[model samples]
Target: MSTIELKNLVISKISEVNDEAFLLAINTILDSKSESILILSDDQKSSIKKSQKEYLEGNYFSNDSVNEEMEKWLKQ
Candidate 1:
């Protein structure tokens, strides 16, 4: 069926219902559609920007190098 038809069908079905808990659950599901944005702190923002700069400057370790270091540490 089309989107409008489906929505209308749901509305008709919901109107015939009288269960408080079920209606609350439906309301919660609808409310979750628009999620809130994350608010980052100054320190976190600075750290992310610093990491991005480091990445752009090619100062980061390779995955193979990190794995080798982890293996050495684990063996010790």
Candidate 2:
């Protein structure tokens, strides 16, 4: 298969994953191989970089924050 086709298949399989650690490993491997692989689009590359930075900086929201938002929506 072509490189882009292989990347698409890998991305599709990655999306089917639900385990956080496994996803991180997959992303890390992809990043390491990036120089030798097809470049990700600007948006996709930005999103991955942003998410990794957020994760590294402990910038994620809590489940309670989501629950509170949901409750507020229900009350409206």
Candidate 3:
């Protein structure tokens, strides 16, 4: 389901819940989500842009291939 649908489902479920403690826990989680702001430095931003360019050029390794190589190296 989409984010909206998932959110509506959660809201519906929470409405059905009558436990005060459980509602408090959910409120705490929502509060923490609002506080999660991230600030990236210029160097980090440049690195991310470079990585995105490389990805768009199809220059990245496949997850399965990387795992296979890691397993082989670990066995050495």
Candidate 4:
């Protein structure tokens, strides 16, 4: 079906829905869909940039090293 037709069909179906729990579930789905944008804080942006720079400079630890440290910490 076309987009407009599908939307109309959905609206018609929604209008026919009378169950409280089902209506709440549909409302929750619509609410989640409406909040699609992600807004990051300035601190989060700065941290992401710093991490990217460190990764490009090869200043991060290796997976093996991190695993070894974790194993040692677990033993302690």
Candidate 5:
């Protein structure tokens, strides 16, 4: 089923459920699972890993440079 259909079904089920328990159960069900499979290109995965390594190694740009670029773009 499509997302809209799935959402409608969930809403219908929740409506029949007791209010107090429904919210907690829904929140748990909606939380992202780390074990879920994802598809990414090798290059994309490599890029992410490289960036993560850089962050871990403390090789990063200062906030000043990032803000300067953002300010320049905002003026354009």
Candidate 6:
């Protein structure tokens, strides 16, 4: 179906729904769709840049090393 037709169908179906929980879930989904864009804090932006730089520099633990560490941690 076309986008407009689909939207009208959803609106029609929503109007018929009487369950409070279901209505609330639909409201939450709609609200999420209309949410404003997120703005990252300076610290968060800096952290992302640092992580990217580290990744580019190859200053990161190997998968095996991380798995070994995780295994040791799980044992503890």
State which candidate has the highest TM-score.
4
Candidate 3 residue pairs that clash: none
TM-score of each model, in listed order: 0.60, 0.40, 0.52, 0.61, 0.37, 0.55
Candidate 2 lDDT, 17-75, residue by residue in tens: 99999988888988888867777899999999999999899998899999999999999
Candidate 4: misplaced stretches above 4 Å? 1-12, 33-37, 72-76
Global lDDT scores for all candidate models: 0.95, 0.91, 0.97, 0.97, 0.87, 0.95
User: Per-residue lDDT tens digits of candidate 1, residues 1-76?
Assistant: 9999999999999999899999999989888865556679999999999999999999999999999999999999
In model 6, the clashing pairs are: none
User: What is candidate 2's local distance difference test score?
Assistant: 0.91
Q: Which stretches of candidate 6 lie over 4 Å from their true place?
A: 2-4, 15-25, 32-38, 69-76
Error of 1 at 54 (Å): 1.0
How close to the true structure is residue 55 of candidate 2, measured as C-alpha lDDT?
A: 88
Q: For residue 10, give model 1's deviation from the true position in Å.
A: 5.3
- For candidate 5, lDDT tens digit of each residue in 6-75? 9899889888887787788676767655436688999999999999999999999889999999999999
Q: Rank the models by TM-score, top first.
A: 4, 1, 6, 3, 2, 5
Worst 10 residues of 2 by lDDT: 30-39
lDDT of 3 by residue, 38-62 (tens): 7899999999999999999999999
TM-score, predicted candidate 1 vs. hidden true structure: 0.60
Candidate 1 root-mean-square deviation in Å = 3.0
